[model samples]
Target: MQKRQSAKLQREKGRARRRRRRIRNVGAISRSEVEASTVADPLCLNNGIYLLVRSYNYINILYSTISLLFSVFLFNRPSLSLFILKGKNYFCIVLAAAMSPWRIMMGMIKEKSIRIEKARHVFEAKEEYFIQNGAMLLEKQITCNQGRDTEPIKIFSAKEIQQATNNYDPNLILGSDIATVYKGMLDEREVAIKVKGPTIYCSTELMVDFFLQQVTIKQLISHKNVVRLYGCCLETKIPMLVLEFIRNGTLSDHLHGQRNKIPCQISWLDRVRIATETSYALCHHPTEMFLRHNNLVDYFVLKMRENCILQIVDDVVLSQGSNEDIQAFAELALRCLNNKGDERPSMREVTIELRRILQLVRSRDSKLSNEIGLALT
Candidate 1:
């Protein structure tokens, strides 16, 4: 009788505890949803409207006065109010056009533009970095929090990045070069972060240059076959480059037994696409920064090729295609492999050639749209 009573009491206690826990969970979820909903409400958009109106008023007043003044001198008669009104209207039209959805940046204000300024890479010890401005500067170098001008547009606090990367856990690794990389998630977007400490041979400038070179290449070229460059992080002097995390493992690993299962066979056409894309990047960007998959190439190539040699072909995203297309791609790859950079064709030439090949391949496949270019070639 005593044992039965004891067992019954324990069961009742457990049931009561579970009920209370369920109630607590419901309350927590309700609170979170309320907070999220409040933050996302469109009612807060009045501030943006207020700023936009202020901007319009300022611009109209300045431009209208100038126009009125010009009309008085040029026309030899001053109908100042009418002419000023016309000028204001024109200014308003231009402003509206600029703010239109079709406009690229939606006439974002200085504050908004700065906020939209994406983080390419954030480095620690950013004191060492300086933006080496070449010809194509979409953005100028910005001062880091240290009040020192470092290369890269801006620097990020290390603590902030640490929070984003979850303290750089091993699982965050996307790919490793000389350092481990982490796939970071911030503002709900995926970012590949490569973190490195100050190295003996590499100064901060050199490191920033390395990532900038990568960005430079991406800026010059874009294709489905190449891994895309998002931006880099130089918040710290010891920087991390954030890139598009290719969820698929490297071609070497997939083709070789390095990843898992039997070494997968890469079709000749797919190899051709990869080759073409690699050549395209080189011809367009032209970098001296040669990368070696030192830790990975040989094992991967053995499974993919009988000769077991992997060199420049290792860092590529292989995709499916045809034999003739493959041949043209191979030629381009050979040009990329050319020891002399000067020997490589200009990007303009390479693009023209690729288009021709694509056209030829399209004709063969019947997938080529006649509208793509009757006059284009």
Candidate 2:
């Protein structure tokens, strides 16, 4: 009876051990399923976050590109810039509707401000000019007793003229004696300032006539080729005449002075053109008057009659033009010097003839160039 009881106790202990082993296996499987679900949830969350960040980066790049393009377009169109400034509130509303970034809208506002300032400056400058123009007109009527039929000439102050001419420095003298011409700056433009000698202003009456003469000269002539009389300063003991500065010196300088000293020569075509232009200028004078000096046309005619025309032409000029062209040019100069003014060709006729001559010469030159090019090829 004791042996049977011990065997039953051992069988119950084995059943209990088997039940504990099955419970341990089920717990391990459940823990593994829970870990897999946790890993899957984290992976899905990470993917969504990455996609959102990438979309934000793309939107930023697109916004930057659009802002750059719009800035470029606005920079070239000043009227559009002005319009934008005029309608800033409207533009702000439009930008807000488009969901424009804060940075881009701020940049446009700054640009609009700059454009408004620039426009204000321009308007102020124009207003100043109008005021000056009105002053000039008033002064013109006071000085000349003339109506407003002509453009008003400026009346420069004595101090302003002195400042421009550096107190009449001797070194700045362009011509001297009867009237001294000095290089000067007026209104930021280079001008020839001619100050009359005290001899001309010996009496008050003579000074008055001199001033009137200047005004009459300015009013009568308005030719492109003639030297322009800009304005004058009459406050000084001897009045000053502010004339247009010709870069190339006077016709006399080119014909017989400084230009002759140089080895370089003037061409025959240029000489003919010069003569033609001078004749045209003389012919167009308001009054008929012969020049006091031995006329240039007469000198050329004398040379032609003496058969020394070649001597009159520069060595460089003789080589370039045809003898026939030179002879024709001399003959035309002679006819211009006819003793009777009525016999001379009109300025209009002279201009037309010179233009015809120039066209013929150019055509000949072009043909010569083509022949030379063919030979070179």
Candidate 3:
């Protein structure tokens, strides 16, 4: 009786063990199924691709529509009589557009390039400034351009800059663009400081590069018309770009003097001189094609002569230069106002031209003096 009872108890125990094992396996399988079917964040990958494709597709469609319209206008499609005479509906538009004005397309391309550069500076800073390089660099030096640096800069305390500007006085405002520019004296030497928005999440390396670019461009640019950049201040957790004090302010301001002047602040000769100087500065890029001072200046002088110097002068003339010095100065102004960047004269050329105008002014003054002396005798 005892042996029979033992065997029955063992069988019951085995049955319970099997039941527990089965439950454990079922749980493991359920967990695996849940893990396998997990959903991902769809917005980043799929959405980014969709946006890029949509943008490119829209651009293509716009260009195609422009092309079609251009063709229709070129064949003078308004006269259906001509279309019927040609005996082809579509070919006329194509042929007319084939001979379409190229200048429009060139202008579009130039505008596009300008916008692309501007957009890169604006949007990339917000969206992708933190994207780190995932690959190894083979080159020793890489191009870096951040507007300021991580290293401590010689920063002016808010108190000091404020005091320099008479306690953040509005009257001390040097320039008013997106941010207010102030004229302040740091280290007893005056500086024009542009206080803009706070430092963003941009790389320090890029700031260093921007500093270098500002320094290099300022140093290499020999033209008198171009503004010089001093070192920038970035230690305040805010990036402050400092530049050389262009006492006269922008050429635009000088050419078109501000509210204080009831009359034009500059004479026609001065206007001409400024324009010529700016043009010359742009054409200073020395290459085999431009040869530093020759080809572009030549073209600039030629076209300017035809147009005359009257176009660029701002309405207000603050002061008149010697009246006798006006015409030659005007002609020089025309040279500087040439439309093509490459065709514009360099600052050097402008300086030379101004000197010649001065000579002309002196000669006229001398002639007038001679007349006075002879009349007195």
Candidate 4:
């Protein structure tokens, strides 16, 4: 009986020990979670701290080196003995130390300004190429559109069109499968001139109707996100559309790294903004304007609906944004890509949602900046 009682007591003691251990583990887990919640984001915090310290150190070293150089110059110079004897050596050293950093800063600013001007000049040269070729046509077109409520859509003559494209220079061609797009000048503006392929239609009437419909659609769309249609040339055997030149090229060029020797890395914020702007354009006039370049955007929508946004996102942009923002954006894109056309959100709704998302991101960034500032202080 005593042996049985002792064994029971031993088992009860083991259970108590186990219970205490479990309790201790739970407490530790809770404490860790609390710490995590209190800390905004460890990675961001650490990065901020590191940058601040690094910049401070750099500035300190720069000033110290400048001061040392001034001291050496003042003490080593034999020709300035009279000036030094006047009790002005220390004052000269102080001036030199202060002016050195200012001079460096001014030099950097001047270099940056020169670079900016060079870039601007390059862009203007591209624009000038178009202006020089279509000077006469531009004058005529401008005269015709003067009294119009909206920008006048001028119909260019075949000769003017030919001259603008340099007789359809092969080098100026942008795309060439079912249709050909040539970079051209219209009304002193850089324009993309799209000409339909001859094999697209068997009947002349059908081709004419298609071109007319396209012209109508282009004329109707005036959204900022949508590319502007300057006019069309119906005088040619195959009609051509004059569209505004978007200097950055297509989104595909940057996203897929095509035609670009140096791949451009698009950031997460930029990707989101692109998606938002695209959706805004797509749903802007869903019933009226059908995009000529709908294939890429449609493909992206399909991939996003499959929850493949993360898979398709460029590697450079993958690490830059919060996952929550990405997921929310993907969800919104999916909604716009819904199979049921009736269930799809309108352009207005998409615009509102995108604006909200952008605001949220900006607020979060501002909050983080404030927190980092406080931490540094």
Score every model by TM-score.
Answer: 0.39, 0.48, 0.36, 0.47
Q: What TM-score quantifies how close candidate 3 is to the native fold?
A: 0.36
Model 1 gets an lDDT of 0.49
lDDT of 3 by residue, 1-377 (tens): 99999999999999999986654333111222222222132232122111101122334335444443443344322211111111112111221212323444766899999999997875555233222211111011123323423222343444455566677667777766544678877777777777642343357555444444454455444455556555444333334555667766565565555554643355555555555555455565542232235665566566555764444433343134453455566565554555566776666776777767756655665787899999999
lDDT digits (tens) for residues 73-173 of candidate 2: 43321111101111211211112112224446677999999999998986676456445443543465566655435545676876788899998887888
Q: After the best TM-score superposition of candidate 4, give how far the Cα of residue 152 lies from its true spot, in angstroms.
A: 2.0
Model 4 pairs in collision:
none
Best by lDDT: 4
What local distance difference test score does each model get?
0.49, 0.60, 0.48, 0.61
Return the candidate ranking by lDDT, descending. 4, 2, 1, 3
Off by over 4 Å in 4: 1-148, 185-190, 197-210, 217-228, 256-258, 282-284, 287-309, 372-377
Please say which candidate is ahead in TM-score: 1 or 2: 2
RMSD of each: 30.5, 25.2, 29.2, 35.4
Let me know the TM-score candidate 4 reaches against the reference structure: 0.47
Candidate number achieving the greatest TM-score relative to the actual structure: 2
Q: Is 1 or 3 the stronger prediction by lDDT?
A: 1
